[model samples]
Target: MSPTTDRTIDFTTGAPVAGSLDVAWVHGAAGEPNLQVHHYDEHTVILRQSKRVTYEAPFLFLLFGEERALLLDTGATEDAELFPLRATVDRLIDQWLERHPREGYGLVVAHTHGHGDHVAADAQFADRPQTAVVAREPEAVRDFFGFGDGWPTGAVTFDLGGRVLDILGSPGHHAAAITCYDPWTGILFTGDTVYPGRLYAFDFPAFRATLDRLVAFAETNPVTHVLGCHVEMKRRRRRDYPIGATYQPAEHRLELTSADLAAVRDAAHAVAGRKGIHRYDNFVIFNEPGKADQLRLLARGRLHQALAKLTRRN
Candidate 1:
């Protein structure tokens, strides 16, 4: 297959096909599906855990290749009865196989990072045959991704048959954090690192360097959307829903552009030495937040929940 200059929806050679992000996502509404699956294209799928099921409501990605499919982040819940993530994924793979039938198709389970909310349901896929579940620890990630001794630098390529994804070692929000870029659709899966909600920089120096790497990569690549695992911001500028809030009626769009990535990079530079939350239009940076910061944030979330309960009662 010859590489074409044009990047239109050419699935024959694994070119990215565009899909809608305009669906009404499950926002803790009654009778919502445990997991909402959106088919970005014939080979690419986006799944979001329902907030009604868990407050994290993290988004997971399933990208199909010629030989195997890649499932990024098992999501936030462990119970299959409540989350049904593995079941949902199994069904999806079955359906995809129906269209593109093959024997011995495998599944490679990996993550954007190893945070509790992100890697909780990994147990679901542990016993599934022909599936390789990558461990969430920093060392495991380093080994699986072939990061070598250059722990938090450089980039590596992972091939899912013909579909090759560029994986960059991104740390800041979490030490083992990474960012993935798909050339097919030009979507960058950033996980919790550069999402719309609160950006928690547990390690400021590393986080700063990670953003710089991301910004430079986006500049060189044809990135269509910069997507994170969660959407924590509201529709209003510089405003975010309280942490742990189950229902968000006015959540911001999940996709961010390269320009938005640059904005985040610039903001990180501006608050180099900051030790607390710095609010911005698209995201809020919690640079090396202290114990007090976490408690206060938790308190605000509790208040939000209380007010929501009262309003519902009224």
Candidate 2:
């Protein structure tokens, strides 16, 4: 599906509308705000940090419920002056409250994984009232989500009032990685584990298992779209932007489908013993890459940066 601008939502039935996601998100331009917020629906907000502020430019999700809101991933920056994530989130909550008034409404700040770029802004929510910022460690995540003895094995349900999410233990990119499925919207938020970018399988076995699980779960569920935290791939097939390239004018769309998930699983299975980058049409999977692989990626990123600078001068 393509990026949509029709953000009309039926609040009574809670049917989500396809919001505007086709616009050019922060392209490292001057005078842009640190964060960009988009409403996928009335109760669902998608926020992205500006690449100018930080190259990571990770995407964050805020889902409102009857009792509380779940803010997934704080962002890539910690300095509130630069990112202002908490302030921005507060304004969003207050605005949302005006429409759906509630007392003692709480906020649960969580993550897709324990990556630094995803949890950097956790400290900003520490002092906020009625807010519980879930710790980045695996133990904290498992405990808060009530993952029981199965730990990173079983699936659990988290009730956000009328909105209930199916939480699966998806550990590949990070040991604490999770894939949240929202029944209300039929959108699966699959963090860094599976996005239209580099799929870094630090633990290849766990990652493969997670992909298989996600595919199977989607088959039995009403999964409309598979959304991830970042967009790094270009519009071109089998190609990705350099690691640190900020201005992605032709970046791939953020939303992937269930078919894409299956494709990723099959591709990952095909490269079970591979130890390097496995390029696909939409995403690239790095299976147990070494330091040399990282260094090469960094070098390519630097080269892209230099080329961008030279092009600007000419």
Tens-place lDDT per residue, model 2, 1-314, is 22432223233364444555555676756778889998887788899998888777899999988888999999999999999999999999999877766679999999999999999999999999999999999999899999988679679999787787889999989999999998878899999998999999999999999999999999998788899998999999999999998788888999999999999999999999879999999999999888999999999999999998999999
- What's model 2's TM-score? 0.93
Task: Please report, in order, the local distance difference test score of every candidate based on alpha carbons.
Answer: 0.89, 0.89
Model 1 Cα shift for residue 162 (angstroms): 0.1
lDDT of 1 by residue, 1-314 (tens): 23422223233453455667767897766778889999887788999998887888999999988778999999988998988889999999998877777779999999999998888899999999999999999889899989897787778988887788999999998878989999888899999988889999999889989999999999898888999999999989999999888888899999999999999999999999879999999999999999999999999999998998999999
Off by over 4 Å in 1: 1-16
Supply candidate 1's per-residue lDDT for 139.
89
Best by TM-score: 1
My TM-score estimates for the predictions, one after another, are: 0.94, 0.93
